[model samples]
Target: MTIDAKTPEEYISKVPEDRKEAISKLRETIKTNLPYGFEECINYGMIGYVVPHSLYPDGYHCDPKQPLPFACIASQKNFVALYHSGVYADPKIHDWFVAEYPKYVKTKLDMGKSCIRFKNIQTIPYELIGELCRKMTAQEWINLYEQNIKKS
Candidate 1:
């Protein structure tokens, strides 16, 4: 669903009723565990955590006007998605998550480069997500982004 929300609360309010609680919990989990320096906002139409321009004035390479995105949570039509740039950029973190996922949820991991899809809302592993949020700090993400993602 395309939600044109200006704030995180507004974004949650626009999601499907069934997904509201899960999204809210996921938001809280991310907020509670994410390292300092990342700000929460509505980014790419989803509730996102980003490295503010104050910390990384260069901003996102794709759109310099925007902050450097670290993670995001979206309630899609078929599933709820958690997008973590760290997992996509760091192979160690990726392998760790992949190895740890089966212990938390019975279903096979459904993931893309950065997007982890939770088709069954009840199966969403909030704790694992929280731990993932803490795996990389804003400065660490900025370094990784510069080395692996941002083009010259």
Candidate 2:
């Protein structure tokens, strides 16, 4: 995915035309499903929905300003990836996710510490993704972020 962001708007603008539409869709999904006390910004060269420090003073990875523990959407050369740090840290969440969203597994999926990757927009289970986002409360996210930080 292309991050290349100097600013949020610029980041969106920089996305290739073929992937921009998918990114736009993901952006809308994130906005519609976001939890309270989160902010949207361009981070790590992509669209990042952030749980700001004010909400979690310890912040992501306990670095305060670093990480930001985001749900990041990116348009990559090979695929689009949805980054959810909090979700990746919890085995129960991960297992439940696969069980709940079988359609996603049917698609081209990749795993990273916090990334869910797809070859294209058609593979994205937007509704389910939204549900997952909605289910992740701020407290759960902060706790997960802290846990992940300590592990790192």
Runs with alpha carbons beyond 4 Å of true place in candidate 1: none
- What TM-score against the true fold does each predicted structure earn? 0.98, 0.84
RMSD of 2: 2.4
Native-to-model Cα distance after best TM-score fit, residue 120 in candidate 1, in Å: 0.2
Off by over 4 Å in 2: none
**Candidate 1 local lDDT, 39-97, one digit each (tens):** 99999999999999999999999899999999999999899999999999999999999
| Poorest lDDT segment (10 consecutive residues) of candidate 2 | 58-67
Candidate 1 structure lDDT = 0.94
- Number of clashes in every candidate structure? 0, 3
Model 2 residue 31 distance off true place after TM-score fit, in angstroms: 1.2
Write down the TM-score for model 2. 0.84
